[model samples]
Target: MIKSGETNSRSFPGITISTDLVITGGGLSGVCCAITAARQGMKVVLVQDRPVLGGNSSSEVRLWILGATSHMGNNNRWAREGGLVDEILVENTWRNPEGNPVIFDMVLLDKVKKEPNITLLLNTAVYAVEKKDAATIRSLKAFCSQNQKEYILTAPLFCDASGDGVVGFLSGAAFRMGAESRDEFDEKFAPSATYGELLGHTLYFYSKDTGKPVTFIPPEFALKDITKIPRFKTFNAKDFGCRLWWVEYGGRLDTVHDTEEIKWELWKVIYGVWDYIKNSGNFPEADTLTLEWVGAIPGKRESRRFEGDYIMRQQDIIEQRTHEDAVAFGGWSVDLHPADGVFSEKPGCNQWHSKGIYQVPYRSLYSRNISNLFLAGRIISASHVAFASTRVMATAAYVSQAVGVAAAICKEERLLPADIIHEGYIGALQQRLLKTGQYIPGLVLEDKQDLVQLATIAASSELVLTGFPGKPLLKPLTLSVAQMLPLPEGAVAPVVFHAEATADTTLQLELRISSKPGNYTPDVTLATRTIPLHPGRNCITLQFDAVLEKAGYAFITFIKNPLVALHFTEKRVTGILSVFNSVNKAVSNYGKQTPPEDIGMEAFEFWCPQRRPEGHNIDLKYQQGIRLFQAESIRNGTDRPAGQPNAWVADWNDPQPALTLTWQQPQLISYIDLVMDTDFDHPMESVLMSHPESVMPFCIRHYRIKDAAGNVLAEKRNNYQTHNRLEFATPVTTDTLIIEVEHPSEQVPAALFAVRCY
Candidate 1:
């Protein structure tokens, strides 16, 4: 090394990089977008301001990612966001089921690192943007402090997944920072000025209990009197991290510019609460509790949301409106917080749940005036009311995945972001996304090029479910529980429930289904029965006189009666599971969401399933066996459970479960895509929760593919992802294809959602 002659003025070393797509943000939205685009054959540059990936979900902030199936706290059954986001979450569970935030960082970093087409620049902040025209972005100027270098990133397409929407803001894209008035969009659920115009930044602290006594002393700036917080009594040494999510601030100030001030205030609140719990003589049990870790930065909820062609409003979410260009879905409630944040005299949030998941149209994902700019995450084109729901991490990632796929098409078609919609290529965009396991509500994969659609599909055995044989486990009816089963479009089947009552009690049972088809709300009650129980084990027959208008998942609900205990079975089927009328306040589930009359939200019961190792199917015998699981379901084009199971589940008794597809003539087959069952109903939370199993029991872990010549093509030992894609090194001409699968356990049968060979 040689000493340099210092000049009057010097600049950092500069480099110019060109990529197909420039994703500004390293959060889940940006990460998923980058991965999706890179996988689709685009050179992607992912710029992040932080040291690590996963904006709010990263270890710096440590907020667990959640979307539809809102913590399994809503009625969105089988509603997990699919595609690369699902892959990331499923992998996180397998690697870090214990919810170590640092482990989660490893998962994201590892995924991005694996993508060869991606260029990830960590600690790179994009401060300035260059415009090609008044309506397009030309390039972005970013600086990396750690490397002491400057980067000029140029791309045809630009995506603003940045939480603060730096690119969108700098590019002069139309954006709204504050809440819209109720009369503007006719959004009745719009937040009143006193309620709050914006959701604020949140910080979290982790605590641990030592076997020996421990103590904590507050810093000089630490809040001495926790009484300043309205909800001071709610804070305890036992709850930390995301469990203390309500501890927020900075809504009243400029969220973008005053973030540092907000961080200080949040720090003041966190330390104050810790001081109150440790030093206040409230409880001697706090002697062993210690602050393990505290977040240095804050997790932001709202900033400047960019504008696109269509601004989704209140009715769009609550009414579950459909869009022709629907590319993604969001089911999280229309959740809004107060401006006063932690110091508010009101409840922390005024959350309102929809009856079902709402679609995010392609029209709302791109800048309306800016021709080449695409929006993602908290900055997407949505009204203040709609953003409350779509602002969630999983949903944001799902929306960005659509953007990624769209960007690939844009680059290939020589088009801008809005051209796909105006040129009537939205269907192509949706179909392409569906091929990659992205779930667009009401959309099904219809690939004419798939070879399996032409083959004569036949399975050795299909599940003809009569009912699960009862196990010895007796669960008390302390909470309302239901057995969810898909029925035919005919008379309701009679079910026999084996239960015992310690004391005499009346068991009230109701048969309910969603008001709309393809929805699992259980809002419409078809019939009700009140049965008297004796003080011993008894067989109760619930014969509903209801006739179905259409086939859908029906709920057999047993109202909570503490005196009665029902038998539950260990037998797990792919499409069948049980739901409980539960309350998980973490995601705003309160048994039932009851809102004021004019708030635009209806009161609906939450029928959610318990996590694995706990969600045993209720043992109920059906007089007529349900024969919906057929071998032909493999080529049906749908991946997950819809109005029907949309999957082919093998019979439990079948020792060698296999499916064979025969073609009249030999065909060249080189690629295979199999959609495995991963318990889509179960929300694989990124952190703060422990999953019962690493791999979904319903997934076919061990599987082999063979040709008619009896030569094995491929064999997988431990498959966990929902979408298993295999591309052979060479094409094989085969007249028939055979798929043999092994169940993970005796309880769960091997099931395949869709298998496509081309």
Candidate 2:
């Protein structure tokens, strides 16, 4: 624990709050710093120049989060970050409803707001840093536009997450920019010598079709033959011209010295080129299509990288080298833009380093000279050549996550970023990462027993009812049956699965999976399917002739089929109305009453066969009526009055109801996997579904889970945040199960598509 005096020292504003550490920049790296520090119970003040979170990927830039994690291997770094980052992903799933950027802003804002230890000052710029001596920074001053005020921050530790390593430069910490000569780092891919010029920036844009088609007109500065460039084959106009070659660095003048001029000229070229393409008869189909996106600001790739304890080089990446302190993974090939401008005949190009993936040492991501600070993201300590490969957002995200964990440890140990890295904290970092759901295929564990156990063991909560042992298999087994059965309404039948032997070395085992439920004794109405299962590894999918619903119940029990798992628990899960409490209220927004016209209910009905409010002392009817009345108010986008309390107007309400009727014994409780029908909030492109505890790191560390009987079933500690769909391997045995949500004190109730439990 930190000394009481130190806590008091950093609490006051304008007092130059001193701490064990300070992180500058609110981008991915800075965000990770605050999250990691907060998890370790450290007080951190995250300063960002913009009003919003997520620098380049934010709606401010409107760039998609590009990375291997978003593409495949749900086990990407975000899964391991497991706290705020995960929350953002979950929220994205909700807001986007379609896995888009609509909810991205909210996700970023929510992450910063939910942390008590993190004081996020938005719309603020760090002007300069105060140095006590040559090595230590005494205070940092920031200008806050909202308050028209200035705040000076002080801390023992500081991280340069500004992408440009602003704090490091200001503090006199050794750093480098541009590509280093091959001989400097002995990296084969590096240029012979280093220069100031580095990879340029890009302005990303996105557009959608309105009811009417829009045409384009060329600007005066348009380049007539941009497409004539040699790299035209790889350039895809439809894909939004993301390839770097499309956005030429500099043709008329030096790009390094004239970035602003270059950016302005490029915009003109972009519009001009689009106009010509749209107007020309060569592409008649694209006439109706116009510029969907025009980036507000350009995304910069290379910048000043802070000097760290260890510098990762291009050789390390190509060799697929492993590090004892490996914290992040990089898979994207190394891409380098030529220093010289691209000519009309041949544009600049990049090369692929390797087909496989490699690990980035955590030591290279923190400051070498600065004792208190740690860095993550693109500004990590790496030569320009190596940064070219690691600069991708996905790789940056993983690096940021690792830094967050390391920063948290620094706070816990009351040490600087430099001290922590040298103290062998890498093992703890790896352990924390795995617990949070991050998949590092090449991650090596320090504990022999733990490493061996993790390698051989396979676990799935879905196998609880079937009695599958949570142990490794020495030899594969398989079982087969020749019976067939049909499935129940909105339900899949239980297939008594077994493990049988296999002769082929590669063929592990065969497990028979029934496609349907049997209604009568030996009613051979459905066909059985076989799936191969690999003991202690691999995802098993049971194939059948029937078109199975992932959202429907996976029957594993016999007495009465209960949902084994909530399939289709994708971004959106469908939910139904169930009432047991009275609720009613008038909803108003901005001190004005919102009419029903503002919010229209497509479906609302009370369906319960025999149950009534008076019977069972349930008051179901009264509760439902109240809920119905308030549901209408939400449609109008109004908030319920402060005095009104009985209504449970869940945000998961939909204009169109899917299933509604009386609750029965074998209740047809089918989920809809609700998705956002449209993007109502402009920037929120979509709402992401997130479990509140998972949205913020501190929530996970301090949260406790309880059963319906008020007994604490489990307490999850450690952060694992991501928005991927959570699949249950086993089904729930209860006839009816109610999921209770306990949100963090600082966070809002997370929006959800549906609550799915079969």
Candidate 3:
């Protein structure tokens, strides 16, 4: 009915189009892939079978976008997914704090639409694939039911982000469905024997209070008795949205072929459950509640996992293995659910947490059989045990960004996906990703375009003893408050404290070591220091003669003094904490508590209870100029290494911090790239918790460049965002270059990730 063409044509019944990259499935992963590729100047076709984007995260399914943070539970600290995914989370937080699914849809749609090189094809399903050979795909045939038209799209590269691995399935890419035997991948957590069963699918519903009584009429398909359901005992009428992930089915059957049947079964369960809550006389609270929204499409958990060059195993995650070609990282626990889903009598799911974050290699992103086929989302190469953690939407989105960036590099270099590593292009891809704000653990950006790298580092002042201060010094306490400080295992060193007094006062400090880090009070007092404080700021030093046998907390406390106050800041560090206690109680046991009036109940708690903040470091070091030179920042790269600080911090007092470069011989430069810190300490998550700053206030708001003679070379004012690349109209030859930066706010230190010149 249609003739083949290069662009959309109405002459034929069907439409034909072409692009450099064809991304199937409009889920978070696919959307990120398309955006990343398009932003890099590649023409991209983003095809989604549904009317909207966000896949499970859309209003249709309403699943929260969870990544490494894992709902802020477990011990996965500071593990939020960065890059394009962070942008979406931040924008959603700013626009929709109530976690409204409708607004989230707009955020994703707006992001894709803003890309000039991206051609969005919503409600278009790619059903057929045209393969050039056994390893290459030539084109794809997609049918858009909404428009009642078919589209034949051709592209050099294809990414199958479809949750079901539809593209890879049609292309005959080798893939595994369901679980694999433990012997297959030597994964200890995997089942002893292989099974065709999968995690399952789920449908969610939202309910709201109408203020007045509401009646519910059951449909013919709804179940009459709720007693048949095993989970009814735990069900509550108030549970809705993602809180009801337990209402699931279809794990025992084919997730794709049996989708309709699964949806019908889930529908019955949802209505039946609603009926029980409304008319069953069991829940009186539901009389004033009504159903607001329900999902028509089931949110699938597992389907076909395509085969790639490397198959990620559970050991890689549990052991925290690092790969040389790792492109992304994931920290979600290995969460596996029974194939029987909600029907099973056992607990819904089992979770195994990792020691920390784990790495995902690039080799696991592209197909091993279909050379030209790239995969993202839950379909990426991983054993079933490993997929449990990587299958999360946020992790999938991060993977998609990696694939998108790699695809752009492939197109630019005229190479295949596998050839990227073979030809040493992986570094370039990593650098580009870092510059674009994709955080790859253990990797650093080494940009050469930064002219500041040649400059001698100097600063007006440097805060050498910089650490997290738990909370601001707002109120003075007459009672002593003990704080817990975690220390590395080994011989203990003298701890220092920075304090100030309005008048001369006697201060007594004690260091007590606790065997358990969670203990609210220490059992043994290892050392003590009694010093007379001066009126102005003073540094008190305490020495401990004991050695810590293991990594534990050193409970330090300053005796009650109403006239003296300890300086504190709101800035939070990862492992430090400010502890608080009940004024009249002493902690009898570690985390256990006695009655409120009990005098022996010692409770050391966070400065702001249930909140996270940094500890105040008494030994603050001050230096003149930036701590690290421009060369260190540019050469070290922008990827913030885990457990290590990679950013160059300037003096907080320097109103106009600047970096200058001077050379004996003049050099020609035209391009300048700058990477600034965007408050990595704040974890960017979906809806419930979002960072307040879309653009960190500490970043340079205004800046200008000049030559040795003080002639303005280029200037930019009202700057925002973390990454900035400026191009000069003409190359300038100069022996000296000075970069002046105006802070967005006074007293806040400037943090530079990298600055490069070319």
Model 1 alpha-carbon drift over 4 Å, by segment: 470-472, 503-505
Name the best candidate (by lDDT). Answer: 1
- Per-residue CA lDDT of candidate 3, range 1-758, in tens? 98766876554269889899999999999999999899888999999999999999998888888877665443343466777887677567656756778888999999999899999999898989998988899999999888788999998899999999999999999999978876787766674322235888999998999999999998999877776777788888878887788787888889999999999999998999999899989899999999988899999999999888899988888667779888888977677777777777766766665545788999999999898899999999999999988999999999999999999999999988888888999888888887777877677666566555565544433333334324445335454656555555666666555677889888887776643332223556777778898987777655656676666556666777887777655543222334443321111112322223321112232111222332232222122211232235444654342333345555555666676777667879887777655443344444423344555555667888888899998888866655677888999898877778765654355656666677
lDDT of 1 by residue, 514-560 (tens): 99887888999999999999899989888999999999899999999
Q: What is the C-alpha lDDT of each candidate?
A: 0.91, 0.46, 0.73
Off by over 4 Å in 3: 1-12, 192-196, 280-285, 466-493, 497-568, 572-635, 657-672, 681-683, 688-720, 726-748
Residue 174 of model 3: what lDDT? 95
Model 1 deviation from native, Cα RMSD in Å: 1.4
What TM-score does prediction 3 earn?
0.78
What would the per-residue lDDT of candidate 2 be over residues 1-758, giving only the tens digit for each residue?
Answer: 77554343543245355665567788755776677667666778888888787776676665555443322211111112233344455456444544344357777778778888888878888889888877677878888877777788887667667776777777778887666766787766664322224676666555354556576657677767756445434433454534343465542343335668867866765665566556655665565566766766666677677788888877666556778777666755455665543333433544343323567887887677766557777888787777777886656766777766676676677666666556777677776654333435444223322211121111111001111122222221111112111122333433333232222122222212222221011212233443443433333333334444422221121111111111110011111111111111110011111223311111111111111111111101111111222222211211111111111222332222121111123322222111111111011212222222222311212233232354543333432322222233443222232223322222111222221222
For every model shown, what is its TM-score relative to the native structure?
0.98, 0.57, 0.78
Clashes counted in candidate 1 amount to: 1
Each candidate: how many clashes? 1, 54, 28
The prediction achieving the highest TM-score against the true structure is 1
Alpha carbon lDDT at 21, candidate 3: 96
Ten contiguous residues minimizing lDDT sum, candidate 2: 615-624
lDDT winner, 1 or 3: 1
